[model samples]
Target: MKILVVDDEPLARERLARMVERLDGHELVAQAANAEAALQLIEERDPDVVLLDIRMPGTDGLVAAEQIAERPNPPAVIFCTAFDEHALDAFGTSAVGYLLKPVKTEQLTQVLDKARRTNKLQRAELTDSAPAAGNGQRTYLSAKTHRGVDLIPIDNIRCLIADQKYVTVYHTEGEHLLDETLKDLEQEFAQQLVRIHRNALVAIAHIQGLERNAMGQCRVRLEGIDTAPVVSRRHTQSIRSLIQQL
Candidate 1:
């Protein structure tokens, strides 16, 4: 995979560059000291992934990531920061990897491998269907799992259930926990998903049927999953209308 290293500190950039050289099947395409130069290089080089730093002279990495995401087929971003406090904010920008300063060779390799896999999957999806136009909404959700960062495709998600602070994403493969709030997810995927209850949002395309249980409580049946999420009375009529349309 082609790579770009972006950092304000010369020593830091050199360290990461050396690491990239040592890794097989990867090439260092360019280096930039700030977000401005990085963006320019991104257009010119079109690297597969970027190793970005948070603090810079101007246009911090976080903001730069948001801008990169707006571009069509943007390269994956892997943040290399010295602080852990920005971890949450980093993932919000659709970053696939987050590593602390003085990054280890093993960790960098792992993250890069994950990024390569994600890119391959995304390319396959594009070939299968017309790519969705960029609208600042994420096409995939990143989750930190035991293996590493898992990129869950938004279209494959069956539903999102909020228990408290974390939302559980039920997808085509299985379920995964996310740190995002349900409200934020609803806003982000409003067109593709619909709210069935206060704590749940089901994918609009996956809704198979709506039925009432023995006690007359409404529940929604979704394709590919046996567990039917309950439908609130307020949303029952809307769900019925949707079912009729289907």
Candidate 2:
């Protein structure tokens, strides 16, 4: 597989290059110091996979991934970082995998294989699933939660709370912390999910209204639900604006 190495540090790029060379069917085609360079190489080389760093000088890896993904043919991204807490949530991006710093050779091989398989699956799905081009809103998601992998429908989600690295997926019956991030799923499902806070995304259809208790802290009420989800005071205006739109 053709690969692109992206990292701000020279030593880190060298380490990844060596690892790719060690793999049987892998070759490093390009290397970049920042997101801009990475984007340029991706447009020119069209690599099969990108070994991307989460943190960079100009643009963070997550934001870079979003930009690349908007292109006509985007490469599969495998985020390399020191943080493991975000591994679960990043799965929403359909990334081949997330590798922590000082990545082991064995782990690299496993993730590479996984990436290859996932890339094939994504291509197949794109061809098989007919596009709804200008019709109704789309639903369904492939998420990794504590209960393992979940093929959750958007309608089933009552609310979503963005934790440090993962988003908590709440349903009518229960709630689960998904290994997926808010940015990964929020934009696509904007009509279905409403941004109550910078870190919190809730199902718009399920929201009943906004509430204020004796404590003066604003709370969000959901239809057919008793418990009220707290909406931070800072996000009060944002919530009200969204409610008016609804």
Candidate 3:
């Protein structure tokens, strides 16, 4: 497996490099002293895994990991940090593993093995399955586009519409077909999304208002979206109450 070591400290970078040399079947592709440099190296080296540090001089590991997750076939992230406080946040960015500072060689080997075994989708699933704590939800939703992997930020999302088996994500930028079911997305983002209809889930923050057509059919107006999704009769009252609070 190809690997990149990203740390602000030179000694820490050297130590990790030496450890990678000791391990078999792995190559140290490059090293970066900051998150910005690491991102650049990722574009150039295209490593399979990155041993990242959480507390960097700029950008920080959490934000950097989100950016990395947006890439097509992004490398697995294994955070090597002195602080364990960012563990949940690390996993939220679809990180495959987390190792405390003064990382042991054995631990590094185990994590590398695990990363090598897991693919991008599997890593996201692992993060979804992790116990919810301290904003453990993913910052962006990944979808396979004709161009490549398209990452839609959760905050920019207006609504998710289900058409038969596929779910389409409507965000601020535009729409993209998601390789996910509406039911699964509803359950995963229950707190941030509201089930306006059996086939639709709208972001709670994007709910502009509820409207009734001339025929008394209810529809929901969402911020930044031209089309208003229909609201089921069963959920109309509930949506009204929700809007009252907002």
Candidate 4:
């Protein structure tokens, strides 16, 4: 069976690649470090099996698998994540196989065989985290950092900017790579945040100004943040009206 291994950790990705090559009858077609690259390679290579990692810096593995499940004749997905606590989240996406890292070589072989026999994949809604925490208010967000998971207060957030396969949450403390989608954040923070661009959402209280450039294109200047978030033409009038209240 052809295989595609996706993991953000360089060592982890290389280890899987080496093992998959040694396994009988299976070929390691491609290796990707993030969800965005994985999706691109999956389309370009069309491997029969995708060995995915659940947690990553940008888009995360489950989100990528959910997208793979959308493609016609999508490849079989086998999650290889360190977070055993996310077992339920993995299966929630209709995955036929799941493995906790560090994955054993013999175990991988077994799952690949199962992939060959697995003919259908069921689809389900994939969510990055629980809808709410702390009395159902979702007052904080859990983000993974190099050291560990950091809990960021919702009130501290200034804006969210979409970058490649991930959306970065910009807050008072610092910036973070959020696993949540831009649309999801907009909906989740609807009362406090508003869309500034298709790729960005800014906090209403943090909104500084909506100014037009020499080109007549509107740009949103955020409070205490040097970078300006471009306001889309489609949302220009709406942002202008909101600026009046500010």
lDDT of 2 by residue, 1-246 (tens): 899999999998999889999899998899999999999999999898899998788888888877877777577778888877766555555455778898889988887886675664432222333123255444545554332134455677878887688777777656666666788668777777777777787788888799889998788998755657778778789888888888
Better of 1 and 4 by TM-score: 1
Which is superior by lDDT, 1 or 3? 1
- RMSD, each candidate, Å? 6.3, 10.8, 14.4, 15.2
- Write candidate 3's Cα lDDT for 135-196 as tens digits: 77766787653222345678899999999988889989899998788988888899899998
Model 2: lDDT to the true structure: 0.74
Judging by lDDT against the true structure, name the best candidate: 1
Model 1 earns a TM-score of 0.62
Q: Write the per-residue lDDT of candidate 4 for residues 1-246, one digit (tens) a residue.
A: 788999999999999999999988889999999999999998899887889999999898888887887776777778899997887777556465788899998888777776665423221111233225455557666564432234567888888899889989888888998778898878877988999788988989988887778988788888867667789989988998998987
Model 4 stretches with alpha carbons more than 4 Å out: 119-246
Clash tally for model 1: 0
Please list the C-alpha lDDT of all candidates, in the order they appear: 0.83, 0.74, 0.82, 0.78
| Cα deviation of 76, candidate 4, in Å | 0.5
- State which candidate has the highest TM-score: 1
Model 1, span 187-240: residue lDDT tens: 878999999999999999999998889999999888887768889989889989
Model 2 poorest 10 in a row by lDDT: 124-133
